[model samples]
Target chain A: MEGFLNQLPIGLSIGAVLLLIALGLTFTFGQMGVINMAHGEFIMAGAYTAFLLQDWAGRSAVLVALPVAFVVAGLMGLLLERSVVRFFYGRPLDTLLLTWGVSLVLQQLARDLFGAPNVQVLSPEWLQGAVGPLPYNRLFIMVLAVGSVVAIWAYMNRSAQGRRMQAVMQNRQLAATSGINTGRVDQRTFFIGSGLAGIAGVGLTLIGPVGPTLGTYYIVDAFLVVVAGGLGQLRGAVIAAVALGLLNSYAEFWTNASLAKVIVFAVIIAFLQFRPQGLFVLRSRALT
Target chain B: MLSVDGLEAGYGRARVLFGVSLAVTEGQLVCVMGRNGVGKTTLLNTIMGVLPATGGTVTFEGRDVTRLKPHERVKLGMGYVPQGHETFPQLSVLGNLLVTLEASGNPQSALDDALEVFPRLKPLLKRRAGFLSGGQQQQLAIARALVTKPKLLILDEPTEGIQPSIILEIEEAIERLHASGIAVLLVEQYLDLALRLADRYVILDAGQVVHAGTAADLQGEEARRLLAV
Candidate 1:
């Protein structure tokens, strides 16, 4: 029990970053029906930005870099969607190849800019330490991750623009007929989704050293959370991430971290084999 | 209130509507009827600006709106309800109503006029549209158009998949909408309900108008021969 509790914070912090990464991926994957293999690169770009900014302006610059990362990543996503992604909205396999190429290009760009060596970033003084009732318990990074989940969920469900996006996600043609500007919705959704990923990258820099391939480490786990939750479901991402966090944490108590992934992957693969749609699908006609 | 003349449109290289022409007078109920693949829905889509007219002049309220966008047409007093009961599944019934109203330059608070057409939707406003039955969704869809308070209300296949009782309710709503001095352009297979409510009828076949006359003339053998009903 002590070992399990000891491992909880570590697993949860990683899962927190995973949740943010997956949230953005789910928007394009689940709603628009695209598998952007290069999405991890957006995270990498944001992490690199955070690293550079932390060095230039001090650790307190995270607050400023966080939003800047969102803009930079979102603009990259916006341009990508308007130019390349517009053609690949319905073509999943093509999207896979295109985004994969994009990811490679982004990683190379980061390597050239930040150098081959991994860069380190520190969280601000207040945001550096542990949170919650127990000392050395929950990580501050995990708290920001948890807060990001809440913020994203609220943005998706509460805001008028979010409703418009959800409306488009639910029924694109119907939304168009109802006078929703579907093109604008698509562009904005891509920006928001990618921007969240950028924020995830900045979050990653908080936990460890930032590098060009930092995004690659978390991409596989992000996909698992997104798929398990059923794509585009904001709440599903958080729930799945938290549950997977606990599962991985407990497993890592006895099993090695690498074996823990095998266990999680096997379970997720088995899950999808049974429920092809996902654990919490919104598109199913269960209501009507 | 709407005039479409010499309209030619199609899916791609193949032409479906061969210079079709039609008119809906002020405050009159006009129904367009045709067999499957007869360009009934296509004409509506072109009229609503969802489908661009390949060659045609669409003038609404004396404005040449052939080039206007779909949302722009809605602003010029044109409301469209597609053949299927299409509504945003994620949005609540109220949200659907508000979205339509917002587009039409109104809001949910100004829905007294729409409520008169579909009082049933008032109670179920909070429910997600995905949860509604086919009939309820249809009612909500029509109400969405009504909230626009358009000069011309265009509904394609408004009665399909609806129960008999609900069809009757829709018929009553249409009659009321017409009586309130709003123009109605309807497409339907329920010939009896259509003929009873609509003042004029146009039968189309293979993308051309086969017959056009008052609905009162539906009694003759020509009606059956032309409609294939």
Candidate 2:
């Protein structure tokens, strides 16, 4: 019972991190239906931004890095959308290949810049302590994850621009006829999606090393979360992230880590076979 | 308020409209009537810039708007309600109206004005539009467009697949819109409704406007003869 209780916080922490990473993937992959393999790199870029900032400014670097990484990653996403992803809308295979190539290019760029070495991000004294059984850093990430989800949910539900995105997601032709600049919506979606991933990168550094390939490992897991969640549904992403994160944590506690991943994939595949549309079914008249 | 001269447009290689020209004056209700697949919707789409014009020009309020995007045209006071009354199904009725209001840069006031115009929508503001009956959805769609306070409203087949009682309601709403002096370019298949509302008429046959005349000229045999595929 004590062992189980001890593992619970770590499971919850893992779930929170998964939620943060998958939030951005939900927008890019689930809502827009774009295959952004390079999303993981955005997370890496955020982490590297934090690393660089910490090297430049010691104690306050972590605080400053959060916003800076968001902008950096968001701008990168916007650039990718304009230069490449925009041209490949509705062509999933092309987007997949293009973003995969982008991932490789970003990986190479990071390796060249940072010399393939994993950098340590020294957490501030404020974040060094623990809350009961939970590490303060882990608790901080969990809070951020919840905060981000709330912020995104409120924006999507209340804001006019967010409603326009919902309209575009439902029907592009109808949205255009209704006077929404669909292109601008697409741009903003990319920025927000990538920006969230950048923030997730900050969370990632709390638990582990910040390295060039940090995003690559999480990218596949994030994709799994999106697929296991219902496409175009935010609630599904949250549910799926927590469920999968806990399941993976429990499985890894009992078995080998590699086998745990294989088990997770198996469970997701089996789950999908039963419920193809996923946990939440989006309601929209398919565009003609 | 709107003029299309020698407009040509198509979907990829399959040409759908050829040299279709018409005029809609201020506060006038101009109906484009045709049988199924005769490019009535295509003409509207071209005018709204959903489909690119392959040839000719579209003038809206004396400016050549042929090359403007669909959203830009809407910003310029041209409102379009496409075929099928494509409401955002997931959103509530109010959400649908708010979309256009937000896009038009007028939110709260536009909502109040739209609700005042279509008071039936006020009670159902919180209801998801997909669950609404076809009539209600159509009303929401039109109300969504009207929230923008567009100078010119273009509707394609507004009465399609709707119940007769609701159809009558839509017709009455059209009358009110006309009375308000908003220029309306309506594409409708219902002969009685078109004749009842339109001051001027254009008949399209196989992607071309075959006849253009006053509504009185299209009263009886000429209407059936031109409309018959």
Candidate 3:
């Protein structure tokens, strides 16, 4: 492969990871008009579930762990909605404060259970194998990321339930008046959101070890993408993810990875300053 | 048929609609007119179950619907085109229509009927509803409400933001719906337009019905003064 073309899959792979994570957060924060600071906790919850399962069973357990994480995170989201997030919805500052507090509590609880150190999971042998022509490259991770995007894209765009979800996301009032049970929609969307996070955590486990403090680090970065993508926009998640992924990769190629993230965060802030509505403003009527 | 009696509703503690009562027969066009802040919109919203009524009885086709959820009311043959025609802007005009069809038990909604009523929607079906002009959106909004083939159609200011000619088209569409035996309950600011099409008119002031009579009674000078801004 040509030099630039050879790097395309890597860029696309990073984009997929960003896309998956961003997609999950979009529903919790974007469509439902939530400021879920604990979204990363859901991701961590997924990772932890996978980690625990990996220790008990063989490597193929990671696949089973994916669904288990989805259920765990989704149940947590439902509980959060019923308990905490519902009260402060539409009050962004209060929600931010609440979720920030929740992140700490969740992290401390995880530390108590799993210890403060990182816990690793072995990738399955099937997923462990690579298909790219290069001996030095491990590109199966790239395929997994792209595959997730395609699956999510199909679910969100083609199915009746998916279309209804889009309806609720686009305009809650109109959708409700159209005889869609928006409360039901809200619950389902939140589940999908949290489940997506769980899946993303599984993806993260494929690349890196998960720690009790896992959620704390990625929460801010995901928030950056949500703000940059024009909150509530699914496509905006894709755009912002790709842009941030490419920018971060290229910046890291030149500068340090930590410095590149700072630049990306700074760029997101600047983007917000210019387009407060986000990159692609989804004309939404969130049930605030 | 539709009926609302002693419908008292509010936003928070501030009561908006006070003892508002009205009825609409099937196939009749009923218009609710009032000055701004008279709770005209609230009355419509209260009946549609968007805003819960503090005290009232709302019966649609002889069934009590006051306690039903907005979407439940919708499933029971109620279609609302709220003020500003709040359609999903991100979706296309086609999407706007398709979304409403979920309310109907019919496998496929009568799309041809909707397109026939609003020809402009045919070309604009592929276009995002928000990108269309205000008039076009208005037409699409009404057509969207009709897609479900509701027994009762409620429109809250269908003429607002629309041009005079398009307003006429909407009025004509209401007339056609009325002719088809669908009850139409409309709240409009334009007195002339309301009087022209309505079989009966109910005027609100401070959430109470200040006047209720035939459209012909509105032609007299006293009712004319009530509509004057």
Candidate 4:
């Protein structure tokens, strides 16, 4: 019973991490339909931002690195969108290959810059304690995830810019005719999406090692959450993340981690077979 | 206020508009009439800058805007409501109107004005646009464009597939809009409606203008012959 109770927070924290990583994909992959295989690298960029900031901010580097990493990763995403992704719009296979190649180059660049070995990110003294089974670090992650979700909700629902983004996502031609600069909106969406990955990377430095290939560890899980959640459906992603998190926690507890992964993949595949559109589908009148 | 000189456009080697040229004076309501598959929609798209023009120039308010983007042309006082009663389906009726009003930097009163023009949308403001009936969606689409405070409004088949009652309402709205002195370029299949609202008419056939004349000419046998089947 105690073991089961302990896994609840663990599962929730895992879900929070999943939510953070997949949030960006909800925009880039879900809305734009651009298979950005290089998204993992943007998360890597965020992690590295924390690592580099450690020299300057010491134990509180992770705190300062959140917004900084967002800009860094956002700029990288914008550069990618402007230089390559824009041309390959509507050609999923081409973008997949192109972004995969970009991801490889980025991974290699990270290996060269930061060395092959993993680096440590020291937690703040304030985050040293625990509340029952939930460590303060894990609790911080959950709070961050909630905060991000709320911020994104406000941005998407309340702000003018966010409304324009939704307009473009729903109907590109109508949005253009309505006086919205769709290209500029696309650029902003990419920036924000990649920035969320950076924020996720900052949150991740709390629980794991910061390394060149760290993003590879969570990329598949992130994609799974987004796919199961549904495209451009925020509530769906939140629900899917939590459910998968709980499932993963209990599965790993019962068996080994490798078996747990296999079980999760099997479950997702089965779930997709039943509901291919996902937990929630966006309704739109736009053709293609 | 708008003029197209020798405009040409195509979709991947399948040319649609071949040297189509026409002009609209300020506040003039011109209707383009044609049979099915005559590239009426293609001409509006090219003029709106949604599709790249293969050749020729488009001038608006004495400036060449041939290479401008769709949004740029819109910002320069052109409004377009594409065919099929399009709206942001996931958004509320109010959200649909706000999307355009916000983008064009129009004040809140503009939205009120649009709602006033289509009073049928007032009761349905909070509802999701996708859930609305086809007629309601069409009204919402036109209301959305009107919120932008456009100098010219371009409509493609606004009355297509709509019920007679809603079509009558739309016709009244168009007449009202024309009375307000906003230049209109309308593509309509219905000859009676076209003649009723238009100050001038242009007939297109196989991607080219077969006839162009005053509204009186639209009543003649030649215009009817070109538009038939």
TM-score of chain B in each prediction:
0.97, 0.97, 0.96, 0.99
**How much is the TM-score of the A chain of model 3?**
0.86
Q: 2 or 3, which is superior by lDDT? A: 2
Top lDDT model: 4
Model 1 chain A lowest lDDT segment of ten: A129-138
| Runs of candidate 3 exceeding 4 Å displacement | A1-15, A55-57, A126-138, A246-261, A283-288
- Score each candidate by Cα lDDT: 0.82, 0.87, 0.80, 0.91
- Fraction of native contacts (fnat) of each candidate: 0.33, 0.72, 0.54, 0.83
Model 2 ranges with Cα > 4 A deviation: A284-288
Mind giving the per-residue lDDT tens digits that candidate 2 earns over A1-288?
Answer: 776766777888788877888888777775567899999999999888888898787856767888998999999999999999988988888999999999999999999999898998887788887867888888888898899999988988999888988888887888898899999998999999899889889878878999989998888888888878877778998899889888888889889899999999999999999998788877644232
Expressed as tens digits, the lDDT of each residue in A1-288 for candidate 1 is 666666777778777888888888988887788787777888888887787787688976677788999998899889889989888887989998898888888888888887878988777777644444323313655777778778877877777777777877887765666666778888988898889888888877776788888878878778888888887887778878877877776777778888987888888889889987676877634234
Docking quality level of the chain pair in candidate 4: medium
Clash pairs, candidate 3, are A230-A278, A230-A279
Candidate 1 vs 3: which has more lDDT:
1
Candidate 3, residue B203: how far the Cα is off, in Å: 1.1
lDDT of 3 by residue, A68-107 (tens): 9889998988888778877776687888889889988998
How are the candidates ranked when ordered by TM-score, highest leading?
A: 4, 2, 1, 3
Candidate 1, residues B63-182, lDDT tens digits: the string is 999998777787778888998788887788888777667556676555777876798998998998878999999999898888877889999999998899999999999888899899
Query: Number of the top candidate by DockQ?
Result: 4
Model 4 residue runs over 4 Å out of place are A284-288
